[model samples]
Target: MSFKYIDVIKELINKIENSQLDVMEKVAQLCAETIIRGNILYFFGTGHSHMISEEPFYRAGGFVPVYPILETSLMLHDGAYKSTLMERVNGLSKILLEQSGATKDDIIFIISNSGRNNVTVEMAIEAKEKGLKVIAITSLIHSKSVKSRHPSGKKLYEIADYVIDNCGVVGDAAVQYENFEQKTGPTSTIAGVLIVNSVISRAVEIILDKGWKPPIFMSSNTDEGDEFNKKILQKYKSRIKLL
Candidate 1:
């Protein structure tokens, strides 16, 4: 049997390498600067997009100063249907940002595949208003095809300081079947995660080049890893609420 999803992801990886290298490096530079300045790097998303926000938080080899703005209502664990409704709600992003304890010195990555939702767009707007740099990870083709759900008449890409296109198709599903009317196998999560990790990994390299030791987590399963991670965790526990 042919694995179509695997092929699709592989194709996306190639596109990312070819088209996104410069922008990814640009974002990495900002990330390295943020770390050197003793600032946090935050990630926010709604619904399934929230998974990308959590991807780097406390992960092995991930940055220690990273935070994910995980609002309960915007996430799917409590109720997926409710989370969808919340993502369209206006004025919620302000509260979410206020509660996340993000400061003007921090940088945020906002992930929304469509980039048209009110909450995500507003989050980008609000973050910029508070003097933080915003990096948007979204599907450009999909966002451009849709109308903005925000009252400001802006999409995430329009409001972000840096936009990293996921290069995904309009509906984000890549596999098509002869008998099926709709495409299956969503690719946004796969593409988005790869983009985020690649940028952060590159940031680590930049930090090293600057002769700074970036705080990174180790796999707890490794010998002595737990001890090392505990110290790192303790250092950021006050700033990173989820830690």
Candidate 2:
């Protein structure tokens, strides 16, 4: 990568590390408590931030019962149930959630670099109205400038019960290039993963504090893989997100 891109990455990493650890702890506590109490977690991202949902969905060493809310269905190609205007990020989310099976006792994680998109704010409002706990992963600086697309004038930050900053720029670090501008950087994907891992680590701490082993999966290549993962899956079965 070019020096400019490297500089951008360093800045974002610094921002994330230098951000309020207090806020991260609080967010982790909320998520951990909710999950342990048997609430579902729904991860939603319309565009590039969709990558945020990938880890918690099917990967090992992740919580079991997480759901990925995307514009597409089981098939990658758009179908009858999928969004027609994939270009319109917000509208696509609305259509997808209208058909979702989310309930009142669930949790919603809205991931967006800008956090000002119409879809994210709409999902947050709808989820809150349905009595779901809302957690937002977005860039604070980026979202500060983008107003809510909804007529109610509420952004993701305003509606979320907990906010985790991805620490990426609002424009997504694409502006650093004089010519070949790219629209993403080290925040939504990198910081998003770090945030999830941190949440999992803290949650494990809490679980262990209760004198129970954390339900983390041992490496499949290990002898204890089957037993450890069995517990993890049994605990987080319904909370795992599917893309």
Q: Estimate each model's TM-score.
A: 0.98, 0.78
- lDDT (tens digit, per residue) of candidate 2 on 145-187: 7776666777788889888888777666633445765654454
TM match of model 2 to true structure = 0.78
lDDT of each: 0.94, 0.69
Name model 2 segments beyond 4 Å from true.
Answer: 1-3, 73-100, 174-186, 219-243
How far is 181's C-alpha from truth in model 2 (Å)?
A: 7.7
List runs of model 1 lying over 4 Å from the truth: none
lDDT (Cα, tens digit) per residue for candidate 1, span 6-94? 99889999998999999999999999999999899999999999999999998998999999998899888889899999999999999
Pairs in clash, predicted candidate 2: 64-240, 65-236, 65-239, 65-240, 66-239, 66-240, 66-241, 67-240, 67-241
Q: How many residue pairs clash per model?
A: 0, 9
